[model samples]
Target chain A: MAFASSRSRPDPAAAPDGPAYLPSSVRNMVKLVVAGGLGVGKTTLIRSVSETRSLHTEEVMTAPSSRVDSLAFTPRKTHTTVTMDFGRLTLGESGETVLYLFGTPGQARFRQAWLDTAYGARGALVLMDLRRPEVSYEAMDLVEESGMPYAVAVNDFPGSPVLDAATVRADLDLHPETPLLFCNALERESSIDALIGLVSHSLDVYRRNTGP
Target chain B: MSRRRDPVRITPAYLATGGRTSARRALPDVLTRLVRVDGRAAASLSPPQHHLLTAVDGGDLTLADAAGHLRLPVSAVRILAGDLLDLGLIQAVEPAELPDVELLENVLDGLRKLKKPA
Candidate 1:
């Protein structure tokens, strides 16, 4: 009950897999995160797979927070975000199940917002930069800590050295059961596969958790 | 008058009320929608509140989308939406209970379909 406060953390049972129910009045709306380090194809993956141009919502950073939160800023930038990049993906011919991709602002200040966005989400597609493995650690760490199920997709950026999954997984120290994938975030099919990999892993976790 | 603009100013929506933080105790999830918006929805609403009612009139939009389109913060949207909900011009889409078996099944089946070669 300690975590039940509305301003505080959301109940995991409420979701991270899918909404508890789909209202007949609304199409089945699902939110999934495309998250990772800055420029790890998080936005690109969403754009590549999204049915529409992504939308964004932002929150102004408090004066002190602007100085501290975003390391990417050059002292002039001011907005922290409540991210909502509404990218709709139709799942089947009937168009019954629609997935909404929410692109996360991959900075630490936006960490809580990232976790909040993951509510009602099936899972997070955590992209990793093979060349800059260190950049992904913070993003992965938050996802891990949030108890949000995720699949790590190593972006097959041009000029990135070819490496095997096992070696990289070991280097990242990721839980073995967590799915790891290699995807070129540029291609629509490849990006979609990375998302499918995450959904598949989340389904397994749900079955494991919700099963007897 | 010396002209100066801080890149980010406190929004008129928030300023017209009090402040943003404590005004929205009744608000639930940030993605919560205003299910109905009619004439009664316009009563006693500040400009931001009116804008929220107008934004979600016919569309199924989350509080975040409203805030994005309106250039308001999530907190501000929550406050304004609360006023509209109280006016009976809007209603929150009821959330379902957890551990939903059928919903999980649908999502799993959907993902499997997406995985198939196309």
Candidate 2:
């Protein structure tokens, strides 16, 4: 169980003879995953922040999946996520690179993939469509079960009821510390700002729990 | 430093699987002894090392699992894993692929039942 420490990386002060490792000024990359129910605008939000030329991830859709997959809630939707969606974005002047704007498949059948994607993520943005509020509990449960901190992003859908944050939190029975924000996923700046806020808040909470 | 020269035992399963073939083949006829430093020194590991050790001790976690558990970048996890390997505290094991769909579905169903509203 013994692991090499991150601090063991050649430190300029500790190892003068050590080769220059990471650039002094370069910011370390931080990964944040964007997750939600299907068609909850995960793609739209990533497209907003991603620089041109996002990476393409293609997975195969197998036929036998029909037997193992849960189609209860999902209508007969074609085009199984033969590919996963991911994007990269830079945050703040620190130039911290954040990879994995991962678009999770919404269907419960894809729960395995979703769990795999959740691996290694610092935190997640769980998107909820106000129109289909009940649909989000499943995603919320996954996030909670993984023991990763997550922020709820209520996407403003047309004709959707405007539920207050308190009401939403009550319905979801989330911990008070979990941040919840309203977002128009179609808007680039707003979505980014929401994510930024989530990251900051999550870091603060994590630090408090684990200490600096 | 307390040095002990324990015979390095390679398991037949490892040899049969042809895992780490190069390292196995190139291993010296006599394995170098491991020197144990003071427990106090070992207790105070760097952040990355601490995270790696925590992940490894938790179970047969993968590099990605360690990174995720520590909330560290993958590159950082990889770098730390290399160090642990050198120290002979951990060894890389091929990850088991996803279970069959039926198995996964059954597991999920079990999880769902467990989560049912009490």
| Candidate 2, residue B24: lDDT | 23
Kindly list the per-residue Cα lDDT of model 2 for residues A66-129, writing each as its tens digit. Answer: 3236344345753244335555443333432223366665445666556655665657888888
Interface Cα RMSD for candidate 2? 18.3
**What are the clashing pairs of model 1?**
none
TM-score of the second chain in candidate 2:
0.43
Cα-based lDDT at residue A40, candidate 2: 84
Going through the candidates in order, state the TM-score of chain A alone for each one. 0.77, 0.73
On DockQ, the leading prediction is 1
- Of the true contacts between chains A and B, what fraction does model 1 have? 0.23
